[model samples]
Target: MGSRIWKSIAFVAPLSGLALLMGFGEQIDEGACSGTLAFEKSRQLLEERPEVLDIAPGSFRWEGDCRFAMQGYADVATAGAPSRRTFELLVALEPRSHRWQEVSFSMGD
Candidate 1:
């Protein structure tokens, strides 16, 4: 009797938790991936690094919770030099509990 009751609770507990999750649609704090988010972040980066003239983020897709992929190019203007280039871009970004941060990136690859 004890074993049977324990088994029933084990099976029902997970199902109940899943039901609660599905009940509150999109209530979880886990962020979502979207082009707007990517574009805004890129714009913020440009502001943070004034040396960068522009970073036009073209497209974005979610890789997972660990990061979202951002595809874009950067136009850089140094103290006495300015250059603009477009190339294949791949970048990884991690979302913290409060904000997102760039982890790794590459261009022309």
Candidate 2:
């Protein structure tokens, strides 16, 4: 009976460790800068701005904590004319709502 218990423990330990590793690996992958919940929320906010006509898929970089820096090209309406401009945004995840909020935004030619 004692040997059987030991054998079961030995068999289960490796499996438990492997499961933990796989779970953490997925979390790391999902936490990447671009394809995350924060990025999607930021994109939605940018699209809703009145001056923004269109936005291209942007590059993203982690700004530590729950903040991110995003840069991309946008077609913006300026003085009744549509022009492509480079834009930068700083966004942070709102912990309470699990949503993203724009911290700062800028655009220039």
Best by lDDT: 2
Worst 10 residues of 2 by lDDT: 26-35
**What is candidate 2's lDDT per residue for 1-109, written digit by digit as tens?**
9999999999999999999999776554433334386678778888999989899857988898689877999998888679999999889876677667899989878
Candidate 1 C-alpha lDDT tens digits along 1-109: 9999999999999999999989986775455555466556655654576656777767666666545566667777756766765533323445455455666556451
Distance from true location, Cα of 64 in model 2, Å:
0.6
Candidate 2 lands at a TM-score of: 0.62
For each of the candidates, give the backbone clash count.
Answer: 0, 0
Instruction: Show the colliding residue pairs in model 2.
Output: none
Q: Which residue pairs clash within candidate 1? A: none
